[model samples]
Target: MANNQRIQLKGRVFITFNIKAVTGLHIGGTESGIEIGGVDKTVIRDPLTNRPYIPGSSLKGKMRSLLEKYKGLRQNQRIGQGYIHSCDNPEEYPNCEVCQVFGVPGERDFATPTRLVVRDVMMTDKSAQDLEVSGRTDLPYTEVKTEVSIDRVTSAANPRQMERVPAGTEFGPAELVYSLYDGDGCDVQKDIEHLRTLVEGLQLLEDDYLGGLGSRGSGKVKLENITVALRVGETYAEEKKLLDKFENLGCLVEKLKELQDQIRQHVGK
Candidate 1:
């Protein structure tokens, strides 16, 4: 497929899930210097309410990176070096799974549009009230964590403070939207494959960390109360309301697997 090729929208799948911090999460914000008597590192917050929230970019970027790594699509570069670019020619690399769902950069020739849409995750009001009642008196909805790095040569310690969203905080409702395109000719199964890949990506994200400082135990999160809905045609009446409800993370994974299997069977036929 080429960028000039025509593509038609078949349907869209909407996935909604909640993210709960299993451990303290530190998605770093702009650095406030010690000169201002502010913390060395701060967590991003809502300006109006001053409540810490996870940016959609953070979650989407993390999921894309993890999925790329899982599919061995990562570039041959050292950590903190550079990012891998997606395939430029979809016709040449027709089976490039990551590029299909996540969309290729600078690839106007790619037939399919970007399939995934991730929304910014906000802290639930219930969770915020719980934090206050739990006696977290440091800040309104965040905690300051003190960290230090020791220089082995001189045995000197450099200390800094970081702001983080404390453990057990719940953020929702996070939404992930996946677009399904009508495949060309015998490749009609492409939409199913893409959805399966997206599901797998989310599963991988659940097993991994979301924000910065993962090696030091920050950014561990769990997805909860996942619900799926589908819109099959152009009109609102064509919608399939709440197709499935997943009670827990494990149940969601299982449902995805079942859906994948069914698609595989259909393709085989």
Candidate 2:
């Protein structure tokens, strides 16, 4: 008979941060396809506000891809498969860290719930106002970056226009929530380990790029003012109290380490 068990909610950790463009950022949007006159690539934007924004999907996808590559988990079978690769074969590999946090596809019989939730990043009010004052005059809040590709044989330069959110643009504060579970056989250590991995993934992302055209001096970004809050147990009161415990990125990491040490002590008992 198959084992039947359900995971129970324990608590949650909420992390908030800011993303500032260090170079032109270009997360692509739908092509206008006005063949006569249109940029080759366009940045994604908010329809109502008409301001460029970063999608949570784009951030999460990029982080997962970077972490997978760092962990050497990017085998041929998993490369474009979209997080569905199996980790059920314990003999081959036990406790796949990536899947446990990011989640495996529904088809995986042993799949657990995804622990991470990334929120869409919107432009700060000040950034929007700055754009308005600067007066782009032509493209509004975005910059039209032009590039030329040389033909190898004829050495002819072909120019194309690319739309991007320019450097110094700020969009955030981005939010990420990590869920902790409670159950009879819950492994708290695993949850802590997952948190560490997730934070490390963000650090790796900071060292890398956010959107597209990274190779051509676009998409460099910096994450700042990271703050984290944690709530324990299953009550609104506890959550309310936890709101006062927000800490900066450094303090938060230290607290997590302290928590891990305490858990280790209890487990050792």
Best-matching candidate per lDDT: 1
Candidate 1, residue 195: Cα displacement in angstroms equals 1.8
**Overall lDDT per candidate, in order of appearance:** 0.75, 0.73
Q: Write the per-residue lDDT of candidate 2 for residues 1-269, one digit (tens) a residue.
A: 01474666666777788889999889999886647677888888899999989999999888877887888773434446454344554333326666667765565555556778899999999988998899873487889998999999999999999998878989989999887764533455577667888887787787899999998999888877776666655453544223323334455555767655543443331
What TM-score does candidate 2 reach?
Answer: 0.85
Q: What's the true lDDT of residue 133 in model 2?
A: 96
Residue range with the least summed lDDT across 10 consecutive positions in model 2: 239-248
TM-score of each: 0.87, 0.85
Model 1: residues with Cα > 4 Å off, grouped in runs: 1-4, 32-35, 74-81, 183-188, 237-240, 260-269
Clashing pairs for predicted structure model 2, backbone only: none
Error of 1 at 59 (Å): 1.0
Question: Quick one: best TM-score, which candidate?
Answer: 1
Per-residue error for 179 in candidate 2, Å, reads: 0.5
lDDT of each residue in 126-228, candidate 1, tens digit only: 9989987988647778888888999999999998887789999999999988766664421436766678778777788778898888888888899998888
